[model samples]
Target: MQKRATFRNLWLASAFIAPQLLLVFVFFYWPTAQAAYWAVTLEPAFGGGNQFVGLENFRAVFADANYWASVGASLLFAVGCTAVAVGAALVLALFADRGLRGHRLYRFTFFLPYAVPAAAVGLTFRFIFSPDAGLLAGINHVVPGLWNPALDGNDAFVLVLLGQSWKMIGYNFVFLLAALQNLPRTTIEAAAMDGAGVLRRMWDLQVPLLTPTLFFLLMVNITDSFVDSFALIDVTTHGGPARATMLMVYKIYLDGFESKDYSLAAAQSMVLMALIIGLTVIQFRVVERRVHYR
Candidate 1:
């Protein structure tokens, strides 16, 4: 039987873990407790004290049409980014997995975008898609109003989606390519020998085999989009001319900092926190099923 290594000094063991415990308490636990406190307590408008309002702040947020709009926008961003990122990365991974000449170079090039910061990606896309003095400007010059995200909410949302999804592709590509490369070679060879074409083999075999990885990417992309999109949306649209690109996180920022509605923002933060925790829990609990061949 294998024996576990024992720490001789309990104080030394505590010392080793103390930093991590401190960090978790400082960053995670502290903020969570703060948000919970603020979520239920409303400060007096005139002065002095905070009144315990229970779920009133939450009720106010739920009753707000703008908050609901932000929720819808967040949902759209999550779904759109996940779908596009997964699909595009899968296609790129499939191609890279072929091990064609210079495939290593291709893989590096494909994944390089993820190394770029989100704000940089946002700035780059913002420049490219800017209605004036951008590439879009040249086209808009010819058509007078071919594209203007500033004036259009859907356009703003699409641009935000594209910018954020573009960053996610490189991340997803690395995972997918590694997963593709690690697939069972014997099954693929058998498929090929049995006269299955590339597309057919991929569709009928490899993709189904990739189910676990795909679902993982889906959950991660959805959760990350809900948060990471703030940087992109802020740079590209600032939640837009009509609040079209306002995701839940961005809405929280607006409410808490800009509008000075701390209690309401705290409530939104709690909701967003629950959503992210739920997603993480779902990923762990639900994504554990192994794929079986009949």
Candidate 2:
């Protein structure tokens, strides 16, 4: 006979979960509902009142070329950071999994970045990168203005990309390493016994098994790229060097806080939300097909 566990005090169970539900509603749903309302309404800079203006805000946002630029930049970041972070993490995780000499130290060091806040990582990289007196300054001291991010928009963007990718790598590495450690050792041993070399075994055995983890990381990295980048960009570039790294999320901040255009900001935020949702749906529908879950 089998027994099913049940909560005798339904009120107690509900009470235990009430805090989490309240937090979700307060943080996520409330803000989302407010954004939805403000997106279609115009609000004056000095806070007169919210005025319902329908989709006029969206129309203005679409008409602005700067908004489109932010969109393009966000997409570029989403793809670039994911590819760089995931690939770099895979390499580090593989090396760590081999348990080579000093691997314990290596594992600990590799994961340190994940422990640091993104804002802190951004600050550290900014100190190391900025044009005044950092790594770039030292390089320019010899090269003579070869890679000044302050003067070069492309250079600034590259810095943001590098910093963002570096921050994401530690997070990806932790999960990838855990997944690698759990994979069946018998499969790897059999492949080696069959005369498969290291690369062959990795390609034929390890990588396929790693697909599910890779897919999950891909989704997470992409989603995080769009949302979590605000703090990094704000600290490092402030979406500047002539708006070169102006991502969609940052654009919303500029519109609302800096420019005092709440309605337009809300509209931009809605668009950003839609973009994230659309990408998530596509990833699940298309990308998940290739994920081998076994």
Candidate 3:
């Protein structure tokens, strides 16, 4: 028989959960409701009054070529970051699962990046990729201006993509390592008995079993790459020399705060929310079917 905790008093249970409920209402629900309202209305730049406009702001946003460009850039960033982060993390987790010498130290070292603030990581990468005196400058000695991200659009995109991927690698590593550890050892040992090499075993045996974790991480990392990357992009490139790295989230910040167009910003936020929700739903509907839970 399984045991479960029960609250005998309803008032006591409500009291115990009240603070969390209040915080969620205040922080999440309130702001989301406000954004939803503002999305369908026009507000004065100085915030004196609001006029309800049905889908006008969204129409304007959709009509803008730059908005489409930002969408493209965001998609590219999300895909590139997700692929690189998940791939690198999986490779590292596989090696770490082998119990190499000082594996515990290596685990801590890898996870250290995830613990650091994204802003700090961005700043660090900014200096590291600087065209003049950065580590990349050393490469420029052999091929002058070859590594300059400051002036090139493609280079700038690559820089931000690498920064975002590096920041996420540690987080994915932790999850991958945990999932790998939890997998049944009997299956792995059976594969080993068949004389399967490490790489062969990983591809044939371990990977299929890890599909659920991999799929979950893919959905999470893709969504996170869309929203959570604003800080990193802002600190590193600020959407770059030609808006090459202008992700949708950063565009929302620029429009709302920098440009002071509250109506447009709110509409963009609504679109972004809808996009994330839609993608999540699609993932659960389409991708989850392929996940092997066992």
Question: Top model by TM-score, which number?
Answer: 1
Per-residue C-alpha lDDT of model 1 across residues 1-294, encoded as one tens digit per residue: 566976589899899999999999999999999999999999999988889999999999999999999999999889999999899999989878888899989888897888888899889988888889767778887888878888988877888898888999999999999999889899999999999998898889999989888988999999999988878877788897788998999999988899999999999999999999999988886565553331
Looking at model 1, which ten-residue stretch has the lowest summed lDDT? Answer: 285-294
The deviation in Å at residue 245 for candidate 3 is 0.7
Worst 10 residues of 3 by lDDT: 285-294
Which candidate should be chosen as best, given lDDT against the real structure? 1
Q: Residue by residue across 142-218, what tens digits does model 3's lDDT show? A: 88888877789888888888888998899999999999999999989998998999999888887787877788889
Misplaced by over 4 Å in model 3 are 1-5, 44-48, 281-294
Off by over 4 Å in 2: 1-3, 44-49, 279-294
TM-score of 1: 0.95
The predicted structure with the larger lDDT, 1 or 2, is 1
- The C-alpha TM-scores of every prediction are 0.95, 0.89, 0.91
Ranking by TM-score: 1, 3, 2
Better of 1 and 3 by lDDT: 1
The better-scoring model by lDDT among 2 and 3 is: 3
